[model samples]
Target: MVSKKQRLASVDALRGFDMFWIIGGEALFLPLFALTGWSVFHFGHGQMQHTQWHGFSFYDLIFPLFIFLSGVTLGLANKSLRGLPVSDRAPVYRKAVKRLFLLILLGVVYNHGWGSGIPADLGEVRYASVLARIGFAWFFAAMIVWHCTLRTQSVIAVTILLGYWLLQTLFGNLTPEGSVNAWVDQHVLPGITYQNRAYDPEGVLSTIPAIANALGGVFAGRWLAHHSGDHKAILKGLFMAATVSLLAGFLWHWVYPVNKELWTSSFVLITCGCCLLLLGIFYLVVDVWHWKRFTYIFSVIGCNAILVYLGTSLVNWQYSSKSLFGGIAAALPQQAAGTFLIACGVILLQWLVLRFLYKRGIFISP
Candidate 1:
C-alpha cells in the first residue's frame, strides 16, 4: 500500500520515457547502425518512423501514449474534483481551460506565430497540431470525470468510439487525401493544414475517438486510484484491463483498421492496451520492486516534461552540437554513425539542462 503523499514514480517515468523519444529519441536509432553495421536494422528504423499512410508504427504510439498519461495524471491529481461543489469547481475548470488555451497558443506559435490558424498569401497556417490534440482530449476527458461517475464515463467512452466507427463506415472513406476526415478539414479548416495535405491527420472529426483514448486512460487512472495502496490489486487490474482492450482492439481492427491518421477506434483500444502494459511494467520495476535507479534519468525528464518539450524547440541543440561534431560526422565510416554523434551531443545537452533543473528540484507543471 502506498501513502497519500507518495507520488507514483511509474507515471513520471513513463511520461519522461515518452518525452525522451519525442525530442531526439529517433536520432539515436539512426546512429546505432554505426555500431552493429546491420543494414537490416534499417527495417527497425522504419518502424520508428511513422507508417506513412494506412498502418500503425512505433512513432504513432508516442503522441497517444502521452495523451493517455495526461488522463492518468488528471485522474490521479484531480480525484478531489469528483466531490467538489459546483461553484467551487469553477476555478479548477478555469485552470483546465487556461491550459487548453495556452497549449493552443503555443501550438500556433510553434506552427507560425501570430499569423497561424489563418490563410496566408503563400503557405496556409496549420491550426491543427500535436499539442492541440492533447489539449482537446484532456479538456473533454477532464470534464467527463468532473461530472460523471466512473461507470457513466465508461459509457460515454464507448458511445464515442461506436459513434465514430459508424460515422466513418457509413460515410468516411478512411483514406489519406480523399477520406471523410479530409472532407471535414477542407470544409472546416479550408487551406489551413500540415504541409498542404488534403486533410489534417489531427483534424476535427477524428477528435471524437481521440477523446475515447484519453477516457480509456481515465478508466485506467480511476482503477489505479481505486486500488491505491493495494499493489497486488493494482497490478492484477491493470493486466486484466489491458488484455481485454488488446483483444478488443485487434478484433475491431479487422473492420475499422487501426489507423493513427484517422484515430480509428481500434487504434485507440490497441494504443491504450499498450499504454496499460507499459504502466504495468514501470510500476512493477520502479514502484513495486523499488528499482528507482533504473528510471532516475527518465524521471528527471518526466518531472519537467513541459520544460524540455518547449525548450528543445528553442534550444537548437542540434545546430550547436554540429559546431563541434561536424568533423566527427565527416570522419565517420557511415553517415548514420556521424548522425549518431551529433544526436548524442544534442541529447546530452538537453539532458544536462534537465539534470541541472532536476538537481535544483525545479519542476514545471501545468
Candidate 2:
C-alpha cells in the first residue's frame, strides 16, 4: 500500500499546482504577456480569460480539473470509510455533507456576501461559478461513493454522462435560433428561466455533466487506492484513463462540442483525461522519483488553499504595496512598476498566511 506520506505529498503537490494559476496567473502572467507587446485580446491568452458565450480555453479547464481532483480525494476518503465499522460510516458521511455545504456557502459568500460590497442582485452575482459547481459536484459524488461499491459507482458515472447527452440532444427546447446549450439551459435549471438574451455562467443544465467529471475522478481514486504501492499498476491505470477519456471526449465532441461552459460529457472526458495525465506526471516524479523539495512551496499553498483564496479575495493586499512600495516604484517612474510591486506584496502576504497556517498545523479542506 502507498504510505500516508506518499499520498499526502501527491495530493498537496497537485493541489498546489492547481492554485498557482489562480494566485499568479491573472495578476502576473497575463500582464507579463501584455508587457511583451502581446495584445490582451489578440491571441489565445485572451481566449484563455473566458469565451464570450461558448467555447473553451486553458483557463476554463482549471475549475473542472480541480473538481475532478476533489472526486479523486472523495474516492480515497470513501475507501477509508469503508474499512471502518458500520457505526462509524454515518458520522463520516455527515462530515462529508457538512464540508460540501460549507464549500457551497463559501462560494456564494465569496461572490455575493455583503462583505465583498458587491450588489446583492442575484442576476449580477456570480451564483453559478466554478467553486459552487465543485461544491455541488463534490457533494453528489460523495453521496454516490459513500453508498455504492466501486463497480456500482462506475455504472452510475457512465449512466449520468450518457443520460445527460440524450436529454440535451433529444428533449431540449429549441432556442429562438435553435441552439443546444441555450435550449438545455432554459429547460433544465430551476429557480431561473433560461433566456437567449444572456448567458448564465452557473446555468442549471451544466451541473449534470459536471458531476460526471467528478465521477471520473472517483474512478481514478478507487483504482489508485486499490493498486496502492504498485507503480506499474498505477501508471497503467492512468494511461487507460487518459486514453479512454480522450477518445470518448473526441467522439462526443463531434455532436456536442467540447465546451467548458456546457460542461458537456465530451468536455468532462477531455478535461479529466488532461487531469489524469497531469496527475500521472506528478505521481511519477514526486511519488516514484521522490523529487520532494521543489514541491514544498506549492504544498504550503495547497495545504491551506481555501484560506489563501479567501484571504486574497477579502483583504486588499495591494494597499500594502501602494502604501509601502508604491512610493519607491513611483520614484523610478516605471509605469508597470507599481503593478508589479503590488503583485509582489500580494504574493508575499499569501505566502506568509500559508506559512503561518502550516506552522500551526491548521489545514483547511473543502
Question: Against the true structure, whose lDDT is highest?
Answer: 1
Give the per-residue lDDT digits (tens) of candidate 1, residues 1-366: 123453688888998898888678777765676678688667667778987766788888898998898888767754546666889888877888999988876676666543443444433556788878888998999888878887888899999989888888888688886688888888886337777788888888887788887887877777777788899999999998899999999989987899888888889999999999999988888888888786897988898887777776666788888987889888988887788889888877788888999999888765
Candidate 2 wrongly placed segments (more than 4 Å): 1-6, 34-44, 78-87, 114-127, 173-199, 331-334
Off by over 4 Å in 1: 1-6, 78-86, 114-123, 327-336
lDDT of the structure predicted as candidate 2 = 0.71
Per-residue lDDT for 118 in model 1? 40
* Deviation in Å, model 1, residue 213 alpha carbon: 1.4
**In candidate 2, how many Å is residue 26 off?**
2.7
For each candidate, the alpha-carbon lDDT, in order, equals: 0.81, 0.71
Model 1, residue 35: distance off in Å is 3.1
TM-score of model 1 vs. true structure: 0.91
Residue-level lDDT of model 2, residues 96-162, one tens digit each, is: 6777778767866666453335454454334555567787888788778767787888898889888
